[model samples]
Target: MSGKAGTETMFRFTCPACEMSPIVDAVIRADMLANGCYLCGTQVSESAFREVCEE
Candidate 1:
């Protein structure tokens, strides 16, 4: 097998409901749309997640 590997850029965001500052460090934009906040289970929206750079 090739030594090269693929990497998906990870994202970070806080839970607005639970107020968990940066609840995760390995989430992607798509994850937010497909799932809820991992900590509070709040319905996730695109606006809810902000790139770590925003901090």
Candidate 2:
């Protein structure tokens, strides 16, 4: 067994418009990436999405 198992960081994206939670688990891949809520269309950054989800 490797100690590095399950050490990967995960990102949880939440839609601000419809409140669709757990949207995507692509944090590191999301860095410098821009995308909007598929459910509605609220444009937001990965970091911004994270902050909103935390609240």
Candidate 3:
């Protein structure tokens, strides 16, 4: 998927609680990534994994 220049494509994952999708701020440089939920601290998308490791 293509996004606006300078702004990276953000993927929203379902939140464990409330089930509301949230966009991740972490940049996705790799094909696969994973991260925890920013709101409920639940496991998020794999794309965020790279960001979590970078931090």
TM-score per candidate, in order? 0.52, 0.48, 0.39
Error of model 2, residue 6, in angstroms: 8.3
Cα displacement (Å) at residue 18, model 3: 3.1
Cα deviation at 16, candidate 1, in Å, is 1.6
- For 1-55, candidate 1 gives per-residue lDDT tens digits of 5544554444556667887756344445566567787667788777766555321
Candidate 2 per-residue lDDT, tens place, 1-55, comes to: 5455555455566655677666355553364245466556677665544532322
Per the 3 Å backbone cut-off, how many clashing residue pairs does candidate 3 have? 6
Which is the leading candidate under lDDT?
1
Pairs with backbone N, CA or C atoms under 3 Å apart (clashes), candidate 3: 33-46, 33-47, 33-49, 34-46, 34-48, 34-49
Q: Model 2 Cα displacement at 21 (Å)?
A: 0.5
| Model 3 spans > 4 angstroms off | 1-5, 25-35, 47-55
User: Over 4 Å off in model 1, which ranges?
Assistant: 1-10, 23-28
lDDT of 3 by residue, 3-41 (tens): 446755555555555576545453532222343555555
Best by TM-score: 1
Q: By descending lDDT, how would the candidates be arranged?
A: 1, 2, 3
| Predictions in order: lDDT | 0.61, 0.53, 0.46
lDDT value, candidate 2, whole model: 0.53
lDDT of the structure predicted as candidate 1: 0.61
